[model samples]
Target: IGVGTCIMILSLLVEAYGGYLLTHPPFSVPYYYVLIVTEESLEMIGTSCVVGGILYAMRRVSKERLKFS
Candidate 1:
């Protein structure tokens, strides 16, 4: 649970950074690639975390049920 929450927070941070990069391009290089990559990575991370959390919770519930029987 804690790890999932942490991942979500990190994803939010990445998204914010990506938005900033889009608005304010870097001096040396254009930030379009950086922004796109960051956005996609954040989305992937968020989705993975959500799916992983759901799987973990389901497994925990199944284990508890088996223990009762």
Candidate 2:
């Protein structure tokens, strides 16, 4: 869970920065396209991490029969 959370957070930071750059791009046309691709890829990775983390937590809780109020 910790590892997944950390990865997602880092990816989010990358996405935010990437979006800002896309809006105010300082790179040339080719690099700008590259940035767009990278940004989308990172977002996908982040979403995957979050989903994985949720699944892991659910599995652990079920295995331990833990309940939250």
Best by TM-score: 2
Tell me each candidate's TM-score: 0.57, 0.62
lDDT of 1: 0.71
lDDT of each: 0.71, 0.71
* Worst lDDT 10-window in candidate 2: 1-10
Show model 1 residue runs off by greater than 4 Å: 1-29
Worst 10-residue stretch by lDDT in candidate 1?
25-34
- lDDT (C-alpha) at residue 63 in model 2: 75
Off by over 4 Å in 2: 1-26, 66-69
Clashes of each: 0, 0
Model 1 agreement with the true structure over 1-69: per-residue lDDT tens digits: 556567667767877876676677553245656656766776677778778889999999999889953
